[model samples]
Target chain A: MGLPVSQILLVTGFLLILIGIWGILAHRNILRIIIGFSLIDTGIHVVMVATGYVTGGTAPIIDAALGKADAAANAVDPIPSALVVTAIVIGFSVTAIMLSFAIRLYDAKKTLDIDAITDSKW
Target chain B: MKRVCAILAVLMFAAMFLGLVQAYSERQARSPLAEYYLTQVPRELGAPNVVTGILITYRGFDTLGEVAVLFMVAAAVGVLLGSKKEQRAKTSSTDGKGPSELVRTGAEVILPLIFLFGAYVIMNGHLSAGGGFQGGAVVASGVMLLILAMPASKLDHGFLSVTESLAGVLYVSIGILGIIIADGFLDSHVLPLGKFGTLLSAGAIPLISALLGIKVGAELSVVIDRFRS
Candidate 1:
């Protein structure tokens, strides 16, 4: 009757990615850039989980109602969700590293302006 | 002009992404491989949660890589910010007033409960929706709360690093044990599969999941400690 929820999620994720990129490009503050990066990471994670969605499927857990034989016809894809779990953790680690770098940069130059830290800029 | 160009570039990227999404035809059980995991995981591994099964068993090596990546990040962050000279110089910056008594009491009261919930999530990972990563993050949040509330309290860096390393070694050893005792590296058949949907079921998956939870929790605590005062 309408576009599936998966497509909607995909679109929403795309929009988030765009917003993140806009933030990164339009903002000069180091904290905002890191925030933009984290947003992009989240958008990617959402798109990943959305890619695995089935039209009318349940979680890929085998229980009383969902037996082994019927699991194939019912369960959503598990691979992407699992990968997304990994992606989310890695994203957090990367964000931490980025923020630490930002802190070090601030400590050195006493500024958070992206343009100001351009000693090596070509 | 640069702002206009950035907007145009982002719009172009969005247009391409929309085109890709429009062409993507959604399906129920799209891949034969996913179908195999869906049906075979329950029967073969006795793990109810196919995602958990696949994460800790089918694609266990990938998970190992992910863990390694996190470990590297933690170490990298430490090296980046853990300078002794900087530590001495930054004492004045971090000596802000402590959190109020109400917040301190609240954190004290809720810390153990948060730990319990994190354990529940980790322990039931093989049988439920939550898993080691989610549980580990929950635990990290509790650690974060303690850091924020007390401010004077310190997480034992030595204990955390030792535990993290020990867990990493144990995880690898389990994988190697699987290669010897079962089909291949990280194979869950190293132990008895027990019964389906039970806590003790799923062979080595639950064990690995627990080890993962501890390892991730420790690593995250280290990251938080490095970032904190």
Candidate 2:
């Protein structure tokens, strides 16, 4: 058979990470760099989420659909799901902070180009 | 030169990932720790949603730190973008006219339902798939829709900060109560674990979820509003 669904997701996540690295290294605009950072964050989250998958398992909720007994066998990994949940919020917070810094930089330098703001470059 | 360097870096990453590809096969079973959470969360915490149980109760300290990080971001963003100078780079759609009539009407109709759904998601976190984070995002989305519809309207800082701080204080207070009453910090057993699969069940999980939802919603709304300046 072909690669499993989680592998496909993992590959996609890795590709996204590669693309994000390219964006960061190649792009000079501060906004694009922020976008690159966001892409990296998203890629990592996707990978984490994909790692949580079980072959034929369902969500980790303890409803009638997913009975309490042997719930571990029936459900996907709750830890990764939980960690990803927190990670997503952290990612949002970091992105907001990055954008805020970008805005302040743009205000002071009057340009979105990173190379143009070389005051701190040594 | 930058392009070549970028390609080289990407290739390096691809090589590294290729080395790890063998481990990416289908997962066969949960780890022992995952098994413990999947079983004990329901039995001890009485929260149906195992992930929610883990985040709110089992991993409560981490959640507190995460919330603190978010709180710090909101403050930092406000400090960064919130100056007295009154200079702002507008979103390029500025023809001096506000949002379209359709957008305004749609926001008016949908805002209440969005808030209602956010509350539902937060309250039903222990019972279902969503929790404070997702529901709080939904609530902030409603605020975003409002901001989109009325670009010139200003959010009240006084009200937003009050609500955010109140939720945060109450959340920590409940965590302390857990020390006094139950096992340890953020112990959900401070209150009785009412009934299985019911609204008021799951000890303090739903309460914590609601507090988290309100705090996150307010913090995010403040953060989103910060982009206005």
Candidate 3:
């Protein structure tokens, strides 16, 4: 059975998510964990955009090239794409915050290892 | 032991995703709302890009929230990294060697072009695939180039802050004006929807989008600067 492009995208997105999860769990350095989290964020974006794809559909734009009626029939879902823009910004913001925290932690402790900075752990 | 655990976790995730992929199907216009937007955007908003129309007009509040979130993050990062001691430590650690002549010249030449492209993207948001968010990122990249290529030359933090605040205030004021003069808050019907597919079309959408682009660009620049120091 030939796998659909959407399914292929989904699988790739999921694989990225898994690799990210593994990185976050396996790595001891704080930066590695942050990198993993970003990978997961990217994976989610890919999955979301992929889910909106329609076979043989064009972008959701109306112009002289594509009439309004034809656009409604052929355009892919626009909501996911719109939402993904916001998601991307929010993800960037979160990543920035995490990196700042990492920097502060490194400055204070002089180490990036997660295990070494566990004085607060009970 | 951790390696084994990681492998097991990855395998489990792969299995779960495989199950999901098995049940997935791709089709055109799955949701009724998607159909509605695809149909009504051009007729109502006079814009060709339905995603831009939805982002800046139909669901503007979410976009506002996004801007607010970025603002908060910038603020938080500034506060987190603003310690005088840390600043001194960073400055003292780095040697005073600036970027090479070639890099400086390239950045100087490319910066204006990046700004122009970003402006174009924001201006034509209603008519094409790009919009405020994407354009804002391009603008931020320009700022990033400045930060990297000319680290000695300081960006005017006060100016960036003022621009960000003014753009944010204007965006909200436009929304409030929409509530008074048009259908509702953040409504794009405040201005006459000009010729379809034209730059002037989509009422306040293009305006709001431009403001959003400026705000996002400034906010990201501030964040990057904070991270640098």
DockQ winner among the candidates? 2
Q: Candidate 1: give the clashing pairs.
A: none
Candidate 1: lDDT over CA atoms? 0.89
Query: For candidate 2, what is the DockQ-based docking class?
Result: high
Report the C-alpha lDDT of model 3 over B77-146, residue by residue, as the tens digit.
Answer: 9888877655665764588788899999999999999999999998889999888888999999999999
TM-score of chain B of each: 0.94, 0.94, 0.95
DockQ of each: 0.80, 0.85, 0.81
Ranking by TM-score: 3, 2, 1
State residue A113's C-alpha deviation in candidate 3, in Å.
1.1
Q: Compared with the real two-chain complex, what DockQ does model 2 have? A: 0.85
Model 1 stretches with alpha carbons more than 4 Å out: B85-95
Checking candidate 3 for backbone clashes, the offending pairs are none
Error of 3 at B134 (Å): 1.2
- lDDT, candidate 3, residue B121? 94
Worst 10 residues of 2 chain B by lDDT: B84-93
Total clashes, candidate 3? 0
